[model samples]
Target: MAFIANMLMAVYQTNISDLFEVVDYLLMLKAPSFKSVYKWRLEQEHKLRERIHAESNKTENSHVMTDTEVWDFIQYFQRITEECLSEMPARANFLYELDDSRKIKFRLSNL
Candidate 1:
C-alpha cells in the first residue's frame, strides 16, 4: 500500500492523468468487491476536473488541467490504496513457486 501511494504521488507529480485512471481501473480489476468505491472515486474525479476547468477560465493563460486535478487525483489514489490494501491479505502464497523477478514482472504487467 505504501508503494502504491508513493507511485501515485509520483504519477501526480509527473502530471500523468492516465496513470490515475489506470490505478483506479487496476484496483477494480484486482478486486471486484471494491467496485463501489471505484465508481464513487471516478465521479469525484470528474467533479474535480470540472472544478479545474471552471477555475482556469479566470486565468489569462488557458490550462488543460488545474492544480485541483492533481490534488484530487492524489487524494483519491491515497484513499483507494488504503481501502484496497486493508481488504487484501498481507501475502498470498499462490505465487510462492515463482521467483521474485517473475512475480514483480507479472505484477507490473498486470497493472
Candidate 2:
C-alpha cells in the first residue's frame, strides 16, 4: 500500500487534478482478495485513459493509446508473469542442486 501511494504521489504531483481520483482509488484498493484488486485496477486503467484523453485534448496534445496497443500491453504483461511462474521450479532446482558453498559463490557472483 505504501509503495502504491508513493507511485501515485509522483503521478499526482505532475497533475494535481488527479489527486482526488488517486485518493478514491486508493480507498477502493483495501479489498482482501487479489481478484477484487485486479478488477479494480483494470477498471481504473480504462477510466484513467479516458480522463487523460479528455484532459490532453484541451491542451491540443492528444496522446491516448490505440485499442490494439492497450491489448498488446495487457497480453505481454500476462505472458511475462506466466513465463516467470513456469520457470520458478527450474530456477529453484538450480539453486537446490548446488552445494552451500557454491550457492553462496553463485549468489555473490550476481552482486
Candidate 3:
C-alpha cells in the first residue's frame, strides 16, 4: 500500500512525463499481494484516461464536457488519491499541490 501512496504523490506533484514513473511504480504494485487493489486502481485510471482523451479531442466550435465527464474526472482522482491515502496515510500528507497544474498543462499542450 505504500506503493499506492507513492504513486499518488507522484500524480499529485509531477508533470505528465513524470507521472509515467508513477505508472511504473503502480505496475510494481500489481504483484499478487496487491492484485485486487491494483486492478481496481487500473480500472479507475483507465476510465480517467479515456475521459481525458475524449475531452482533449473536442473541437473549439463544438466542444464541451458534460457534467458527468467533469464529475467523472473529479471522482476518478478523488478515488485514486483516497485509496492511496487509505493504504498509506503518511505519504498522502506529502503530496505537492500539482494536480491542477498538471491538468492545465495537459489541456494547453493538447490544444
Candidate 4:
C-alpha cells in the first residue's frame, strides 16, 4: 500500500510538471496575446491554490505529504510562476521589436 501510494504521488507530480512544461512551450510561441497569457497564468495559479487547500484538509491516506509540505510546494510553484509572468511583458516587447534577422531564445531555467 505504501509503495502504491508513493507511485501515485510520483505520477501526480509528473503530470503537474508536464502541464507546466506545455504551458511554457505555448508561451514561447507567443501566438496568444499578452493578455491571454496573463489570463491563463492567473487561472492556473488559482487552480493550484485550490488543489493545495483541498490537499491540506485531507486526513486519510495523507502519507503523500503533510499540510505544511503542501503549502511549501504551493509557495514554491507560485513564486516561480510569478517570476515568469512578471517577465512576460518584457519578453513580449522584445519579441515584438525583433526583426527577422534576430531571434530570441526563451529559456525555462527558472522552472
Best by TM-score: 2
Angstrom error at residue 32, model 2: 14
The best-first sequence of candidates by lDDT reads 4, 1, 3, 2
Residue 109 in candidate 2 has what lDDT? Answer: 16
Query: Which of 3 and 4 is ahead in lDDT?
Result: 4
Of 1 and 4, the candidate ahead on TM-score is 4
TM-scores, in order shown? 0.26, 0.29, 0.24, 0.27
lDDT by residue for model 4 over 6-100, one digit each (tens)?
77668967896677565643333332333444445555556766676696864455344444555555553453355555655453323322222
- Cα lDDT tens digits, model 2, 16-70, are 6554445532211122233333444566666767787676655234444455555
Off by over 4 Å in 4: 1-28, 58-111
* Candidate 4's TM-score: 0.27
lDDT of 3 by residue, 66-106 (tens): 54555554554565545553554232323322231222121
Candidate 2 wrong stretches, greater than 4 Å: 1-44, 53-60, 85-111
The residue pairs found clashing in candidate 4 are none
TM-score-based ranking? 2, 4, 1, 3
- Candidates' lDDT values, in order? 0.47, 0.44, 0.45, 0.49
Top candidate, metric lDDT: 4
Worst ten in a row by lDDT for model 1: 93-102
Question: How far off is model 3, as Cα RMSD?
Answer: 15.3
Candidate 3 shows a clash count of 0
Of the two candidates 1 and 2, the one with more favorable lDDT, higher being better, is 1
- In model 2, the worst 10-residue window by lDDT is 102-111
